[model samples]
Target: MSSVLGVSVGAGTVRLARPQHGGPHGFVPPYTFEVQTLAMPEQRAEEAAADAIAAMLAAAPEVGATTITFRSDPQARAIRAAMARRQLTNYQLVPEAVAAVHFAHATTDMREVSTLAVYDLGSSGLTVSVVNARTSDVYQCERISDISGDYLDSLVREQQIASGRIAHPADPAGLAALDALCRAAKEQLSNSNAVAMPSEQGLVLLTQENFEALMMLAIESSARMTRDAIIRSQHPVQAVLVLGGGARIPLIARVLERTIGVPVIVPAEPETALARGAALLARPAQVPQAPAAPTILPLDDEADVTPAWLTAPARRRPLAALTSRSGQNRREVSAAALTVSSLVVVAGIGLGLGYGPEVLERGNSTDGSQAVPATTSPRPTQAAPTSAAPTSEAVHATVAAPPVRQLDNEPTTSAPPSQGPNTFTVVPGLPPVVLPTLPPVVLPGFPPAGQ
Candidate 1:
């Protein structure tokens, strides 16, 4: 830029900056800077900015190259109007956020910053801006109306009144005066441990600790809003730049740093940072192409998102998706094994009922004498065999034989017990004098009775 004047017209103050230059008249010594503070209104800020610049030029024609910053349509209109009225055309308007980034690049080691959060705590309200460091494009921004310098001033005023240090003013003019006094005290408290101001009733004293205590909630609210802006931007912010008069209060940076979990950057002159940055833009300087905002992950310092266990890992998640298939399989196999064992038991019981008693009777034959078998039930466990009568629903063997282990594959006959192996015996039929020998009985799904 051919001009070197940077102007930022804020709600509470108008900041102007230009390079150092010597006076155009006579042989004057060179001065470092020729800038002035102007009172600007919020609604007509742009128009006031134009008026102020024109007035400055009128006073000092050699203020030299001038650069102004503007953000809205009204600013442009105001600049055009100022130029047309002043009969001068040596000015350029730069975006305010872009100018601040330019200042950051010039002053500090901003290599770590790609996305910058400009927390401007001005008089009327707070504006949180997430801007790209390279192009100075705003990615996300928010205007918080609840907190501001004026609000903090009110808090100080109320606390001072409550302490009995000052009586509440009766008239509007007096109230305004007291408020102004409190505002100054608040600003002083930023740099000093305590500030004492003369008021209506007495000297109102406010300490730095007390001031921070009174404004803790408001600063925390600003931090919360800033965190939200970062989350909405969907890009991680490396650092934050604190601007405006409120930035002078050290507590704001501490709370913001703790809450946002990032560095809160404050320049040498925070109240005039924007103005100086604009002034830098008014001059010809290299604007570094900062790397693209790093998007390592979605960042929410508050981390107010749905819990991961509730929605993620839809397949085979250890916590949410437990399977019972193995337990069910084990139960199914046990049932099958129980069924096979039951069938084998029933078949063995049937074979014993049909043949055990008959084998015992054949062993009791009188024609051959032999030693009795060692296997026998106790006398109480056995029942006597008889052949007197037959009255039964069906024929049955009454012997409950103990299982015997076969030692050899040879046929051998064993003598019956002296009593009998039967628990109970069925009676023989009438008119049946002799009984023939019974052959071995074969049942399905079994080997022959004798090999």
Candidate 2:
């Protein structure tokens, strides 16, 4: 009896399916891990891939298997390293989006459907697959950056700041704390009308209305991308299918339905459908058999394929062929790339120069609107009974006066009794400032006239 292992690596969970004979397949308990560090610049996506794979392997060590399949397109080195570490050999990495296609074909008897769109809103990104329903194949997959429900959490934080509802903390501490709060709020918002993030800054309350308002952009983008995927599938979509954790969001399903003009089909356990489909693909009878003539399914025709699941479009590339080219072609492509980079730099500089002044001017205006505090002089305003108010010139002269009488030793009878209204003499060594010179005096009585 042959057995197969199917692994689905998601942002928040890693699912493993082990198909056993004559019953529901056993699944590994879901492993929850944050893809936080995976967002780092270097090797981050791969690191997330590897960490997820490791979790899957750890979950199902006892499943008798010669082959391991992955929804993630793992790099050869990473897979090899994993296999080496596990001391296992047979492995295959394929698109996770193809899971439903595999599952549909295995369990259902229908084979004529030609096109299906897979809407995958995973933890990190929103992915849509346009596939040929006939071949159990994918035509294309497109992903948007951070458009998942997790991303909606970020939108919520931004809305909070924009609405003056809350203030984010500073730097690393702030980021970590905000992440925690947003995540908690997201989970709570999923279930309740409101949630609060209690911190030293006080509680930040988020209502469902606020959450949806925050997520409008992401929701709209996801819907638009889903619609475009259906359009690009180049087939009259028989159905628009929803899967992934984000699919569980009612708002997402509603948006997809409204956008695609088809009822969003929410299959049972949509999150695990992909893993189940992969395991089903491992079954001999479930594998797609090629037609005798190696016929390519027409983009319009969704038929004559094994497993209704696998009957989707295989990956298709445009048929343009490149004839032999000289090194000049390489140089041309490089030059084009360099020109694009230069244009980007110029655009950036233009933006900075054009907007930088406006920003500075606005800052100055804001400063001007604020009241300037008056400085209180330490000298008493109340006059001594015998003294008159000093004239402005006298005050200026007094302020301009330099300190004299530096004492080398303790005070003695030799110390000067200050005279001449405490005239202050200039010190010998200090930084000096010169005021503008008065106009040169008219020559003395000697050169009268032009002389």
Best by lDDT: 1
lDDT of 2 by residue, 353-397 (tens): 443332333334433331222462322322222555344444434
lDDT of 2 at 275: 70
Residue range 239-330, candidate 1, lDDT tens digits = 99998888889899999899889888887667777777776655443358988995556768886465566756654476443456666778
TM-score of every candidate: 0.57, 0.49
lDDT of 1 at 373: 46
* Model 1 per-residue lDDT at 136: 89
Give one clash count per candidate, in the order shown. 3, 19
Q: Scored by CA lDDT, what does every candidate get?
A: 0.72, 0.59
lDDT accuracy of residue 277 in candidate 2: 67
Look at candidate 1 and give me any clashing residue pairs.
4-65, 5-66, 5-67
